[model samples]
Target chain A: MMLKYPNGKPYKPKNQTPEQVGTGKVKDFSFGNRGKTLEEEINETNEYYLSRQIAIVHKKPVPIQIVKVEYPKRSAAVIREAYFRTPSTTDYNGVWNGYYIDFEAKETESKTSFPLKNVHEHQITHMKNVVDQQGIAFTIVRFSKLDRYFFLPFSVLYESWCHMKKGGRKSIPLETFESKSYEIIPGYNPRIDYISIIKKFICNKEC
Target chain B: MMLKYPNGKPYKPKNQTPEQVGTGKVKDFSFGNRGKTLEEEINETNEYYLSRQIAIVHKKPVPIQIVKVEYPKRSAAVIREAYFRTPSTTDYNGVWNGYYIDFEAKETESKTSFPLKNVHEHQITHMKNVVDQQGIAFTIVRFSKLDRYFFLPFSVLYESWCHMKKGGRKSIPLETFESKSYEIIPGYNPRIDYISIIKKFICNKEC
Candidate 1:
């Protein structure tokens, strides 16, 4: 089904072949991820965390504006017309070891730099508010081509966002990711294993 | 639009007249809430808290499952066939002064007791998980006919839920609410000032 972003931009699904993803012949080799999107991987990780009594996190449902509905006899209500609404906050949030955790997940095929347009203005504001409340806020970025993932704190992202608004580079370079973000390795059971990276951030604050 | 619960139960909106709500002709006297539902009141309160930097909370968007879409050229995509899905978690959650706050809001016309059917098994389980992770979890129940609101903690709700599961009382008695729950007064600016009640919970944990 067709979907649209909050800005009314048509949502485009990334179409990557094994060679394009650099997982080519090793595709048969199981990293427990066989062409799953970042969302699916993160969801699997969350399930693992929940079952293990580690954390409680969830991706908020996509916001939709319902225009019409049909109630049939004794079955269920069917929405006849609706449109996607712009989300005001980040995609994922919950409690982890008493800390309020909030973050967004995005994937890019570009290996050199991640585009700023992938993130939104209101999302930045939401993250800033989360940080102001002393909640842990960050972004999980996947470099699809390089098969790499990085956890970029909201502080680093906000800095780049402000620089772009002031006519600086529109994308964050790979060097920035190397310097400012923590790389996360994928695993079998917990797919993304992002909570470990978050643990480091918590340690920095408390310990 | 018509909506249904996760258990395929048709959602029934509380229809209370001014007299039934016990506000009588004083309804127009303005509590800053004329005929607003509990969800509306809580939403307004959250907005107030956000603007004042007192707390950051939100009501989660309703879950929807899209079946078909029409992507017309030069215009936004339209969802033609969709249905509301059963939500897996509570309706509202967010951070409040670094605390992971999570809760569900419900309203009932019955003044004697709050019906157990208003909450679901999965919701109880979700709240249990949140509490286990050291998050503040509770339910905000509005006794519409009595014009009263109560902050019922997850533990109290869970006990009642367990009793119901074991063929005990199917509802929580009003006396239990009077004895165990904290009362929340509807105000002019925030409408339902629940954060003050939550502050009491935080203090109990710390002190």
Candidate 2:
């Protein structure tokens, strides 16, 4: 028994029970990653992948504009006055199966659409450059209200971006994402297994 | 006249003068990049390439471990206490012409060897991982005293690293670098056209 969209289609994304996905620490999918954000879960997944030789990925450390630093006698240098720098690209990027993969992870509470305002201009340009270089680029959108995660390829996002640039709607509707994106189920070891979706959709483009 | 190493070999790296390399702003190579370091020159070169749509290389921002933050204003969050985090990979990495490139730029005043101290343990593992994944990996060594730049491929560095792991010499002799690495001449437009060296040495591997 799930709710229906205005277009009459069901809004549920392959409903997987917590028993099917969780192992120990993260047993509840409804809480949206067991008290962690989507980004943290993905970072843990990346670490899991790197340790196991499954894949190599990393969240680019958040850029910070360091204004001043103080080196204490026997302590680490402490950054005193600093501001967060505008990110020039996506959050995560690395080598995956001998191919480059760049992606941004975002979460929204909106039920109908994922707003474009959450992403930056330079980030889109970066994704475009990655695509032009034949790299696999995508975005992971998590709808917190629905406890749903979807992996949207750059191709689809680029189209929507272009449409927005041409004076179109700025947000990608949930229905639009429903048809175009791949659903990501949360699990214990890898909270988000987005690589499976990448391998399925992007392997041909890479090889 | 060229200086001689202890073994009586002439120290030379395809000698090119400032007049040959410079066009406008970076004319005085005798100052060794107009008071700018080798890393700065490489960063400028990366920006030049990025602006021209030639490549997408970026110096990963210095990682910092933030322990505290203060909301100084309603808008800005000022980092109060944070320490610099140890980076797990090299300083630079990107996608170039559909191939992945990872590298570290280093400088030394010592005329004998590029000290292994300049390279870190995790960085070596990272370069190995990049090579294992069929990506092009290398290091840029700027001999400041000699005003020479050499792009040493991971293959060459890996060999030295393995030797060190077996209790061999910790530094790679400049003579060995002369034989194995590509000498990069400083230039104006792209401060360090290391990509040219990449084209010559790594293009084949990528293709």
The digit string of per-residue lDDT tens for model 1 on A1-207 reads 546564644453244342333221122333457777788789879989989989899999888766556788875666776666678899999999889999999898899999999998989999999999989999999999999999999999999999999999999998999998889888887888888998887777679
The collision pairs in model 1 are: none
lDDT by residue for model 2 (B146-191), tens: 8889999999998999999999999999999899888998888898
Error of 2 at B47 (Å): 0.5
How far is each candidate from the true structure, as Cα RMSD in Å? 7.5, 11.3
* Model 2, residue pairs in steric clash: none
Query: How large is the i-RMS for each model, in angstroms?
Result: 7.3, 11.4
Q: What tens digits encode model 1's per-residue C-alpha lDDT throughout B31-108?
A: 446667788789879999999988889889888766667778875556777666678799999998888999999999
Runs in model 2 lying further than 4 Å from the true structure: A1-32, A203-207, B1-32, B203-207
In order, the candidates keep a fraction of the true contacts of 0.72, 0.53
Per-model TM-score on C-alpha atoms: 0.87, 0.82
Per-model DockQ against the true two-chain complex? 0.42, 0.26
Q: TM-score of the A chain in candidate 2?
A: 0.80
